[model samples]
Target: MSNPLSEAEDSPLFITSLAKGLALLAAFGAGRPSMNLVEMAEVTGLNKSTVQRSAYTLEALGYIAKEPQSKRYRLTPKSLEIGSGYLQTSELIERANPYLHELNRSTRESCNLLEPSGTDMTYVSRFASHKQISIHVPLGQRLPMYCTSAGRAYLSALSPEEAAAIIARSRLVAYTQNTETDPSRLAKIVRKAHGDGFACSNEEYYVGDIAVGAAIVNAEGRPLGAVNIAVPFSRWTLKDALADLAPQLVNTARSISNAARGLKPLVSPATG
Candidate 1:
């Protein structure tokens, strides 16, 4: 498969410094929240001097900050503004918010709006259940597409070949005892989701987390994302949760999709 970003790198308009800065920012994640210049260079594969320059720029921009005692760099709350900017601008989130809240209210479970990112599904929006037993899935958290209900739902909306290609590219490691690591088995599950209009994860990604999801499609039937409701195993059985909540989840997904299609085009008209 051809990489669009790599292809763009050959364009004269491609800004190398901007790309390097973004890469430097991406280098600081959950596992590596705080990094020294050497660590940042190692992680981003940039030289020390380049990393230093980019780090200084990011620090100046308030996206990153250096610790006084450790001399390590960490992302600041200001960096969240970048993601917040996206959420604020997204029509999908706007359209899906009410439905997500409705699903959460009806199911009394944590509801999520997830979008596929390469081989993972990222939580873009969430409505936390007030119930005591609910699982907490924060926005921007990425889960393996191979073992998640949202990922499977998104896959189910794709063509068989496309879904297969995505699964082949995924690192199908067993996240839990229930996680189906075999490509063939995972494919079968995705096929079932395609037919059933919903996908289920029975403690696949996390041992105690059970979720059911349905794909949100555009007017062209292309998947925009997925809507998921998560419950803890201690409170509800997978069978009971699917039996009770599946219909509501599918309906909520459809409502969001329809609302999304009704919104005005995001692109601006070309001016002469």
Candidate 2:
């Protein structure tokens, strides 16, 4: 596969410094909230000098702040303005918000809206159930396409070849004993999802969690993203989820897709 970084390096319009600064900002997350210059360089694959320059720029701009005691950099609340800007302006998210909340209310389970980001599905929006649940999937959490129901649902809307290419690029590591890493098997599951209009994961990505997902597509039948309802195993069985929640999940997805028909397509064409 061709390297996107190398391709960007060749582009005349690509801004290397801007990319470095953004990459540095992205390096801070739930796991690594703060980092020294060396840690930032390692996480972002940039040299120490570039990391230093990017950190300084970001600090000056109020996106990140350095701790005087430890000399580690952390993202400020101002950094959220970047993602907040997208949420404030996104039509798709706006349209899906009410529907996802309704699904959460009806199912009494956690619901999420996820979009394809590289080879993973990123949670763009979430609605938690009123009932107590052990798992908490925060917005922006990413899960591999091969083992996630939402990922399979999104992939099912693409051409078989396109979906296969993405699977080929994914690192098929088993997150649990039930995680299926076989490319061929995953392709078959995606095909089934396309036929059924919904996909399911049986504790594949996370233990004790089961989910059902359906793709939200444009008028052209291309996926813009997916809607998922996740439940803990203690509350619902696979058979119960399929019988009760699957229909509602598919219906909600269809309603969103219908609303999205008049909008511009959000999904990019297959690069390969």
Q: Which stretches of candidate 1 lie over 4 Å from their true place?
A: 133-135, 262-272
Q: Write the residue-wise lDDT of candidate 2 on 34-142 in tens digits.
A: 9999999999999999999999999999999988999888999999999888778888899999999899888888989998888888899999977997887877788
What would you estimate as the lDDT of candidate 1? 0.87
lDDT of 2 at 116: 82
Best by TM-score: 2
RMSD of 1: 4.0
- Each model's backbone clash number: 0, 0
RMSD of each: 4.0, 1.5
What is the Cα-based lDDT of residue 233 in candidate 2?
Answer: 95
